[model samples]
Target chain A: MMPIAITDPDDPRIEPYRAVRERDLVGRQHRFIVEGEVVLRVLLQQSRFDIESLLLAENRIDSLSNALENLPPNVPVYTANRQVMDAIVGFPIHRGILAMARRAPLPPVEDFLATLPQEALIVGLVGLANHDNVGGIFRNAAAFGAQGILLDQESCDPLYRKAVRVSVGGALIVPFTRVASANAMVRALQGASFEILAFSPAGQEILSQVKPARRTALLLGAEGPGLPPDLLAQTRTVSIPMSGGFDSLNVATTSGIALHHLKSQRS
Target chain B: MMPIAITDPDDPRIEPYRAVRERDLVGRQHRFIVEGEVVLRVLLQQSRFDIESLLLAENRIDSLSNALENLPPNVPVYTANRQVMDAIVGFPIHRGILAMARRAPLPPVEDFLATLPQEALIVGLVGLANHDNVGGIFRNAAAFGAQGILLDQESCDPLYRKAVRVSVGGALIVPFTRVASANAMVRALQGASFEILAFSPAGQEILSQVKPARRTALLLGAEGPGLPPDLLAQTRTVSIPMSGGFDSLNVATTSGIALHHLKSQRS
Candidate 1:
């Protein structure tokens, strides 16, 4: 596909890019923006989403030539100067690359679980409203080979721009879907024969000693309030032994440690 | 200490709280500001720093009464109504609590190392300038029983307000001192009989298999640049085994996993 030059920031072709900050605050009409060079590369190379279009600062085009060469023939590549790009994005275009993409409908929780490999590891999140935590957890999930992730309805969308950037494109690579509630997620995983290990400060088992089953779902909750008391009571919960009166670890950091332990020690 | 009511935003006694955003850009003299209720609790109960004073929204005083009761006798507590507090802070006082505290001189690197117990696990950071990463690493260090931390000069201050907030008071609890360079940090740890394990993607040992020495230092560098080649060469190196085409984990998350692994399996 040829690169289309966009001289005006208000051009209708680039309407989606206008006032990017305000767009992020509202919905994106079922599309998500991929920002920066790295995540754009991931989107073009391997993301499951279908590319709607690409916007690049003219100067960044040459450097991204190799990646652009592989773009799907129908995808339009739009170029703008620094000033135009800044006005369109409503911010300085430092990284100079962005992509608009859309995902297909996600599979239901039970159907998603049935499709996992016989021996699999996944992460389940509950009430994780922080985008950074959600993104970091996705990054950890990818790094440690947690093939899938399940977020309860209360969790924020992983496709939110900041979350994707923090995930370093892990959000694009990993398979994820939201379930209606934490109970529904737990029930679905258990029905699939996966052992659920809920993480909490008052957990019954120490994380290091919990021998996980062939199929394991490591569950985490928001920082304070943790996994709710009802969830804790229903699941086989485990805790990372903390010292010096600190029971807090950022939820994302906690996910990383838990993912590493369970993934590494999986039989 | 009784709470002193201040009706004026520009009251000379509350000058330190003015234009906090701009103040953060510049230095906060020799003092640091602590924000929110949880961190305030940590500061009053366990921090080594001397409390200079506190500023709270008038309505917040009743909620913080228990924590205020434990404050040192000489520390002043200033209260302002929402309008005055917002004007003074240059932003809405959503969390409604803040404290100013100052620290004594940090020990020289060698002197700091001399204080560690025989069986110690500590983290050493190099070029990690992101405040969130620094704070998250400190929180992880405290959680996994890593008693102390060493940072090369390039690392951001863990006491920076955002870092402290992200650390959830781990910054106040974990004793840390910065050194001149990564090389100097390694040398000091070695002199103190620490087995310095620099973490990198190309590291020689897989993290799970590497048995840590009684006194171990888990050395981490910034995310993209990782550890310097010479530094990696000079120290024993280890890596968490990652999967697929992904090699990135947020540096902070890396510290949490490594700290847990080494701390748990220590002889």
Candidate 2:
């Protein structure tokens, strides 16, 4: 990749990176940002997403250069003084590297199940809009051996910069796809013979009591107002038993514990 | 309670609630901003904490008047126009209510443990600087039957505004204390005949393999660089099994899963 120096914060060439801060507000714009050397390097290696541009501080270019030596020579690399780079990003950039990449096209609901391995356990998210929780869910899904994540239409973008950082790059590895609606996603999973288990604090069946199945989907919702009543009515509800005084766990944490219990039962 | 309305943000009586954004940077002066009507009401009802002042938007006063009717007449209630309230806080004020409370003193290590009921399962945090994670840990601890939280000196303040808000006011309900050192904390727990289980990705014991005890402390570290080497060595290392090709779960989520597993085993 050719390295170029940038001095101005308002340089139009870096528009894609600048747009990242407001990506959430611009709904139709599906683009998002990814930072840090580790996440950037992983994305470059994947070859699934389109690379927009790269940014690095001048003094730290050599170290990042050595790591990026294998990339195509034509990829654009922008370098700036430490002060100039910090001004543009609103924080001291770590890993001395940042990359903007185009989000890859999400697979259709049918394709999502088709790509899943046989006898896989899946964590399905419906109407969960918090980016941090989305990232947390991905991190837990990876840790507990969930095969992949399935997102309903109402869920937030997993590729959002905050979500990616929160997930610690697990968003890249935990294959995910978005469906048209929660009902449609549930119907697709049911059609594929996957048992749908909706998690609720008041669930009648204890999560630990559920028998392991060849294909299982643990459904989760956002905090406060949990799963919509219709969705809750459609799926088997399971609860993680808790002490009397306590109310409920964060949605992501609940998913992790449920995932662990479900996966451990299989073993 | 007598309702007093003063329209100025700079009023001397409202000094306790001023410039709360700087509370995080003020070391000696520890104060936390609690927002929302329900949380404020709960905190007031608990009476374990000292309320420095209360801020209410002019129109919101009547709505909360019934709830505030029981407060002691001496408590100061400051009123601000919506614009002034929003300006005082650097963000859009929510629920039209805000409370400034003095930091509560953390109980001594021995006292914290002594207060727990028999067969306690506690969550311990070390070097967890993120307030959100700290708060999430509290929420999980409360949800999964953990008796209390023990914080290493390096951990962030759980009573901080962000932590309290992220925890959904669980910080008010859960009991927690800070220790000067991880070694000293572990020694205290060991002295109390509690098992110290350090959670790390590279542990010899799978979480499922270890049975829960009557009194157990699940030790957790920050997400990226887990438990410090010395701290890890001080406790028995344990891990939740992960699928191949995945890194680790978020520290808070891991604590939730561990708490759930331990609580289930105990019951």
- Top candidate, metric TM-score: 1
Q: List runs of model 2 lying over 4 Å from the truth.
A: A1-15, A22-24, A27-31, A45-53, A65-78, A83-95, A245-247, B27-31, B45-47, B50-53, B62-78, B84-92
For candidate 2, give the DockQ.
Answer: 0.70
lDDT of 2 by residue, B95-206 (tens): 7788877777778999889888778888888889998889888877766656788999899988887788777677876788999878888988998889889999988799
True contacts kept of each: 0.93, 0.91
Tens digit per residue, CA lDDT, model 1, B1-267: 788999988799988889988988897668899999998998988787889899998888989998888898899999988889999999997988999999657899999999999988899999999999999888888787787999889998888889999888889989999899998998899899999899998899889888888888999999899999999989888988888778588898899899888877862
| Model 1 spans > 4 angstroms off | none
B58: Cα error in model 1, Å: 1.0
Note each model's CA RMSD in angstroms: 1.5, 3.0
Per-model DockQ against the true two-chain complex: 0.80, 0.70
Query: What's the TM-score of chain B for every model shown?
Result: 0.97, 0.90
